[model samples]
Target: MESHDRLCRRLALLAGTAVLAVDYRLAPEHPAPAAVDDVMRALEWVASRPKELGQLLPGTGLAGDSAGGLIAYLAACGLAGTPALPDVLFLAYPNADLSLSLQSVSEKGEGWGLSVQDLAFYIAQWVPDASLLGKFSPVEVARAQPLPVRTLLATAGHDPLRDEGKLLAEELARGGTDVEYRPHPDLVHGFLTLDAVSPAARHAGDSLLAAYGSLLSHTAMLRRDRNAPPDAPNGAT
Candidate 1:
C-alpha cells in the first residue's frame, strides 16, 4: 500500500477527487476475502465515525485495478441495496476469473509480463483452498446478479483476463446496468502503472479519471434531489 501512495495522490489530483485509500492485508499471510473484509471494515469505521475522516467518502463510487479490481467489485456487490452502494464502479483490467481458464489465457498469456503460470502461483498463495475459488470469484458471483447503477470496465488488448472482463461487462449491461466498456487496443495489463513512460497509457488513464469524476458529480446531484423535500423544484440546484 505504501508503494501506491504516489499514484493515489496522482489519481486524486487528476480526477479532482478526495481519496481514502485502504491499506488492506495481503495474501499468502492474509488470503482470499481478507482484503474484502478489511475494505468493509474500513468503510464501516468511516461511515460510523464520519467526523474522523470527513469529506473523504462521498459515496460516489469505487475504483480498482488488477487483482484489487476483483476485490472492489466484490465489495461493491456486498454493499448492494445499502446506502454505501457506490453510484459508479470503475474496474481497470480486473482479474475476473481466478481459474485462469479464460480464452485469452492462451492467446496473450505468453510474453505479457503476466502469464497464466504466474497467475496460478499467485492465486494459490492467495486462495489456497481450491474449493473456495468459486466463492471468491467475481465472474461466478456476477453472473447471478446485476451491478450498481453504473459500471465502467476497461480491458487491455493483450491481457489474459481481457475476455472475462469483456464478458462481465456485457452481462452487466444486459442485466440493465449502465455499463461503459473501454478497450485499449495497444495497451497491455498494468497500463495504469505504466502511464509515466507510455503516452497512450497516460491518455487512457486521464480519460478514465475524467469519466469517473464526471459520473460522481452527476450521481451526487441525483442523490441530493432524491433526498430533497417535495416542494423543491424538479431540477433543484
Candidate 2:
C-alpha cells in the first residue's frame, strides 16, 4: 500500500491527475486465483467509495504495470455491469493471456528483459494445471455485456507480452469497447517503470501520460456538453 501511494504521488505530478496505484497481492506464494481475488476486492472497495474517490479526484482511473496490468483487465471486467466504470485504463506491457502462446516469447530472443523461462516459472507457480487455463486467463473470459471502459493499452516491441496486449485490444474492440493501443518498438517489458535509467523507458512513460491527458480533455468536453442548459443559446438550442 505504501508503494502504491508513493508511486501515485510521483505519477500525479506528471499526469496532472490523481492516480490510484492499487497494490494487489502477488502470485506464486499467493497463487493466481488469490491475486485476482485481491484485485476484485480492491475494485469493490473503490466502487463503494465513489463519492470519496471523486472528491479526491474527479477522474478516477486504473493503471498498472506487468502483472498488475493483467489485474487491471480483470478489474474492468469485475465492474462490467456496475455503474462505477473507471474513466480510463492504462496498461504497460500487460500479460492478458494464460495460454502463453505469444510468439515474441520465443521469436524475439532475450532482448526483452523478461524471458520465456521466467514466464514459465511464474505460470508454474501461479497455474500448475494447464487444463484450468481458461478459468484463470483474462482472454478466456467470455465477452461481458457493455464491454470494458475506455482503455489505453501499451506494449513494448521487445516484450513477449506484446502480441497478447495487441490481441487483447483487438478482442475488446471486437466486443465494441473503446481502445487505444500503442507499442514502442525500441522498448522492452517494464519499460515505463524503469524510466529512472533508460531514455526509451522515459519516453514511453511520457507518451502514456500524454494519452491519459488527451482522454481527460475529451471527458471534460463531453461533461460540458451534457451539462449545458438546453434553453441556452449554444449548440444545444
Candidate 3:
C-alpha cells in the first residue's frame, strides 16, 4: 500500500479529488471475494459518510492499478445501481481478463517485471477455482452488460494485460459508455509504482493524473451548469 500512497496522493492533489485507499486483505490466505467484499464495504462506508470523506461530490470515482484495478472494477460492478456505485472508473494496466487469451501475454509476458508466470501464480493463489475466473473478470461482464459509468483506461505497450484492458475499453465504448483510452508505449506493467524510481514512468504518471483531473473538473462544471437556477444571469450565481 505504501508503494501506491505517493501516486494516490499526487492524483488526489492534482484532481482536487479525495481518495480513500483501501487496505484490503491479501491472497493465498484470504482468497477470492475477500478483497472484493472489503472494497464494497469501504465504498458503502464512504458513500454514507460524506462529511468524513471531505464532502465527496457526485462525480466521485475509483482508480487502481494491476490487480487492484481488477478489484476496483469488480467492486464498481457489484455496486452498480446502488448509491455506493462510483461515477467513473480509472484502470492503470489492469488485468481485465483472467482467461489469458490475449496475444500480448505471450509477446511481452517475460523479461518484464510482471510476467505471465507471475500472474498465473498470483491468480492461482487468489482464485484457485478456474470456473470463477469469468465471474470476476471485468471484460466478461462488460461484454454481457453496459458499464454504468465513464471509464479511463491506461495500458502499457509491453504489458501482458494490455490487450485485455484495450478490449474492455472497446467493449465499454461499444456499449455507449464514455471511455477514454491512453496507451503508454514505452512503459511496462506496474509503472504506477515504478514512477518514483524512473523518470519516464513519472512523466507518464503525470500525464495520466492530468487527464484524470481534467475529466473530473469538466464533469463538475457540467453538473454545476445543469443545476444552476434558470433565472440566474450568465457568469453569475
Candidate 4:
C-alpha cells in the first residue's frame, strides 16, 4: 500500500476519519486466497469490535482499487449473509472477470498501462490453477447474490477492464443492490495511485475516495448523535 499512501491520506483528510490500511499479501509470492483471506480476517477483526476503530460509528466500509478492488469484491461476497458484511463498498476499476472473457480485454487492453498480456500473467500468477478462476472471479461469484452492500463502482474509459467493471456494476444492481456506478471517461486504470502525479487522476480519484470517506464520516457522525444534523453530500473532495 506504499504506492497508495497519497490516496489514503487524502481520503482521511477529506472525510475526517481514520483509515486503517491493511497490508494484504501480494500475488506471484503468496498466491491466490492469501490476499482474500487477509482482508476477510481484517474485516472480521473490525466487525468483532467496531468501537475500537471509531467510537459510536454508525457503519463500516470496504474499499479497493484495481486488483485490490477485485479482492474487496470477492471478500465482500464471502462475507455476505452475515453481520460482518460491510455497510458500503467502493470498487475502482476492478477486473471483475478473472476468466478474461470480457470483450474490452481484447479490444482495449493493449496501448494502455495494463495490457492483456500483462493482465494474463498477473491473473495466472494469482490463480495458478486455471480451474479455480471461476471461483475467484467476481463475475462468477457475484452473479446470483446481491452486491453485499451499497456500492460505488467506477470504471476507467480507456482501460481494458472498463467493460467487465461496468458489467459487474450492472449485474450487482440488477441483483437488487443500490449501486452508484461512475464511469471516469478522463481517467485510466490505477488512478487512485496516480493522484500525486496527475491532476486529472487526483481529481477523479480523490472525489471517489472522498465519497467513501464521506460515508465513514457520516456513519461516525450519526452513531455519535442520531440527530446529528442532515447528511452531507456524497462527493466531498
Maximum-lDDT candidate: 3
- Model 3 scores what on Cα lDDT? 0.86
Residue-level lDDT of model 1, residues 43-79, one tens digit each, is: 5665565676665534466788898888888888887
* Candidate 3 structure, TM-score to reference: 0.91
Residue 227 of model 2, lDDT score: 78
TM-score of each: 0.91, 0.84, 0.91, 0.87
Write one digit per residue (lDDT tens) for candidate 4, span 93-133: 99789888888888788887889999999999999999999
In angstroms, the error of model 3 at 222 is: 2.8
Residue 131 of model 3, lDDT score: 92
Question: Could you tell me which 10 consecutive residues in candidate 4 have the lowest summed lDDT?
Answer: 50-59
Comparing 1 with 4 on lDDT, the higher-scoring candidate is: 4
Could you tell me which 10 consecutive residues in candidate 1 have the lowest summed lDDT? 52-61
By lDDT, highest first, what's the ranking?
A: 3, 4, 1, 2
lDDT of 3 by residue, 1-237 (tens): 787788888888777787788999999999978998899999898878757656556566788899998999888888988988877788999888998889999998899778899899998888899999998888998888787788889999989999999998998899888999999888999887777699999888888887787787777777788887788677885
lDDT values of the candidates? 0.82, 0.73, 0.86, 0.84
Q: How many residue pairs clash in all the candidates, one count each? A: 0, 0, 0, 0
- Model 2 score (lDDT): 0.73
Q: Over all chains combined, what TM-score does candidate 4 have?
A: 0.87
TM-score, cand. 1: 0.91
Error of 1 at 211 (Å): 0.8
